[model samples]
Target: MLLVFVLILIVVGLASGMLGSLVGIGGGMVIVPSLLYLGLFSISPLFSEVTPQVAVGTSLLVILVIGLSSTFAYLKQKTVDYKSGWMLFIGSGPGAIVGAWLNRFLSSEQFSLYFGIFIICIAILMMVRNYLKPVVIRKTFLYTAIGDNGDEVTYGYNVPVMLVISFSIGILAGLFGIGGGVLMVPVMILLFNFPTRIAVATSMLVIFLSAITGSITHMVLGNINWTYAGCLVVGAWFGAKIGAYLNNKLKAEYVLAIFRFVLLFVGIGLTIN
Candidate 1:
């Protein structure tokens, strides 16, 4: 059963990482929902009795690995930018530590309610943002919007705009034990009017900080299920590479369409389940 559970997570990790790489959503969204479906693990409370809080804590541990592998893979692609990514990390790190402690103070019901709220909004926002925009390739690179044609286009906005985005996304990410890429992706799209590819790559860069922040706090809480975490990382690494490759190969709509659906499914499933 333990091995089976690990296998399930590995598969989930691969799918989430690949989609995440292409869409800029991170693996934690999938991790939390799937873990909830899983109930809980070999801990003392048994599966059903283990509170949602504990499940979240455990999921954070696994997501840490998923986020790390994804981030590193994206970085190698030069998709992970250092300047904005670093600042975002600074803010997220402390937020994650504090949020984990706060969760410990909350009751199980409180945790579930908060989690539900977190899941719902992001889901709706993700679908709306992706669906409305037409995917175009551009060579904006670090500037903002992507340029598929030789006519390079860049958003007029600057780093401060991105800074605000980092902080807002960081808080929820800390609370939810996610990379916060869902929120980040849309913000990049609207705030900077960035293209899907840049948005996806940039979101992964931010995940490096956000997930690390959340994961460290979960670790301090001493709730990680390491066995599962290891398997998740192994699968996610390869998955991210494949996703990155596909990201370069596929059209923007192809990735975003699937990405949006995954978020929708995850968001609704978490709320209803």
Candidate 2:
């Protein structure tokens, strides 16, 4: 039974890591709910009775691994925007601390309900993102990158505005163990006119930094399950590499379409369960 449970967790980690890296979400969206569902059912005696706090903390730990793996892979491709990622982390770091503190207040039921609704909202946003016009904000920073086809792509953002947005997203990351990229990717592409690949790559960097702070807070709170975390890390480490490789091959629009569907399905399942 213990072996079976470990295998199950590893599989979950693989899926979560692959999806997380591909989309820059750090795999927490999948990990949190999986932990909750397994705990709710008492799937294994070795790690039974997983609470929301533990689930979130454990997810964040796993996310740390996923982020590191994915970011390393992205760096090799020269897709990451390090300056922007660090700038965004300034706000997200403090916000993550606040969010981790806030997580102590939620019950399992509350966490599930809120997480479900939040995921559904994000799914809806993904669906409509292409149709929505980018908000016109004065640029305080500009960046240029060479595309796969050698065309120069330019993007820019207002630093203050982006910091505020990153802070808000960071709070969500810490609270839900989601790594913040679910929202950040869309915001970069739609709001800041970033190329899809660059946004995805850069989002991983921010997610990595935010996960460090968020996981540290959870560790201080004793919310982590080291046994489970270890198993997840093993799978996620390799899965992230696979995902990063695939990200370069896949079309952004197609990947997002599938991601939206998965989010909606998972959201509805989490809500009703």
Q: On residues 100-137, what C-alpha lDDT tens digit does candidate 2 reach at each position?
A: 99999998778888999999998998899879997877
User: What does the lDDT come to for candidate 2?
Assistant: 0.88
For model 1, how does the per-residue alpha-carbon lDDT over 178-244 read when each residue is reduced to its tens digit? 7777777776666656555666776777676666667677777775656556666777777777777
Kindly report which residue pairs in candidate 1 clash with one another: 137-147, 137-148, 138-146, 138-147, 138-148, 139-147
- For every model shown, the clashing-pair count is 6, 0
Listing every candidate in turn, what is its Cα RMSD in Å to the true structure after a full C-alpha superposition?
4.4, 1.5
**Poorly placed runs, candidate 1 (over 4 Å):** 40-50, 130-150, 156-161, 255-266
lDDT for 131 in candidate 1 is: 59
lDDT of every model, 2 decimals: 0.64, 0.88
Give the per-residue Cα lDDT of candidate 1 at 139: 22
Q: Which ten residues in a row have the lowest lDDT in candidate 1?
A: 133-142
